[model samples]
Target: METRIRSEARSYLFVPGNRPERFAKALLAGADAVIVDLEDAVAPHDKDRAREAVLRALPELASVYVRINAADTCWFDEDVGAFAAHPAVQGLVVPKAANTEALAHIDSRSHARLALLPLIESAAAFTALDAICHAPRVERLLFGTVDFQLDTGFGGDGEELSYFRSQMTLASRLANIGSPVDGVTMALDDAGEIFDAARRAQRFGFGGKLCIHPKQIAPTHDAFTPTEADLAWATRVLRAAQGSAGSATVVDGKLIDVPVIERARMILARAR
Candidate 1:
């Protein structure tokens, strides 16, 4: 199968693999992509059941992903081995991907032309961001906020994790991949908290936010999509640059350059 990286505005929703009833609903829930999670979402006793359910439901899925457990765990080998033959699985969101060796091993074994989105949770992974992104199979980097917070011993909100988040985003850009994805906001019932956290992620240059519940999808998408005002401004900026010779130009009394132009084009493309 031909593989493509996730380019559109992303609001990936995670559904527990054992919950087959929620699988169909998640696909129809208007998320950019659905992540059938067998890792954190599944209890120890339910791992086998979740795997079977996900395999059974794969044939019916239109656009979604399967997040298997970490490769270091007892279930990791089984998880990858079981799904190796499934063609419908679009990509693998590998959790706690500490190095390129793990990614190489997974890619070498899988038959599917599966893209990899490595989860950068540990300090080791963060420190090795360059080598990880250079891995031929990696397509994007996903920041695992909660795991990161725990790994770093940060308490309360995730203010302490900003440096790591910024570093991952920069690494992804330098590696010439799609924008980095922000981790999920775990407060499922509170829309206000979800929006605030997602917005903060956006400000930090995250292209998307992961969602644990379907209810968070719409709000996350809305927060990520560019507004009409933003589009209009981008258009004016580009028009101003049309007659300029230098690398930078003035737009709306502000300086604009290649980065600004690129961001403007991204907004307009998504708006289209």
Candidate 2:
């Protein structure tokens, strides 16, 4: 059932938990999903109030993903008991998940119906990527590139994170999970830059992107969607394969095999 959300969602707009007023506006913002954040976006002193505000707002929220604090934080355990079992919270985004133990610990407290999204941040997470990806109730992984750069001492923008982003896309596919969502773009009101960043991630195999504001949602969605040319090419490729009786076919100077045909079908499916 979580696949329903993963397939259709190309943009997740985040709203700080403490700001209940913006939550409604965010839900109305046309983002694929609204993530009520209780993690990095909220202040340490405000955790309690934010959690309460989120819980109070959950039933009113149709379908929302709540991002909980790190597993090791003082607020972590309390967060799980408070909302992991709540009927109104459709999903929980677990931050700083660096190992199977962390996931296991959270899983021990979380309900099976609750989709879990683990943020890959720390260097230790890279070492335990396999385990983290397959953990119980895991819907998908999310690349926390900003936090990752801080952890790994990497010093460039999206370019420096290409290899890492590629690994995330590969890992998700290997685990039969949906493509991971890329981190946020800090720049504001620059749709072109946001679209370019999102398109780069999409080309690298990411399925969605995180948005800090509603204004980024539309451009991010635009980036992930296939263009008319792509739809046309996929249509031609599939038609060629069908006519060839699933045998090898040459289209536009490229050989179309089973894998290539399958990719074409997927592109067309997404286009629909």
lDDT of 1: 0.81
Q: Give the best candidate by lDDT.
A: 2
Task: Please write out the lDDT profile of model 2 over residues 120-206, one tens digit for every residue.
Answer: 987898888878778877778888888988999999657888888888888887777778999989987999999999999899998
> Residue-wise lDDT of candidate 1 within 203-232, one digit each (tens)?
878889888888898788778877889989
The true-versus-predicted C-alpha distance at residue 246 of model 1, in Å, is 8.3
Identify the runs in model 1 with alpha carbons over 4 angstroms from their true place: 1-6, 242-250, 255-259
Report the alpha-carbon TM-score of model 1 versus the true structure: 0.89
Model 1: colliding residue pairs: none
**What lDDT score belongs to each candidate, Candidate 1 first?**
0.81, 0.86
lDDT of 2: 0.86
Task: For model 1, state the Cα shift of residue 40 in Å.
Answer: 0.9
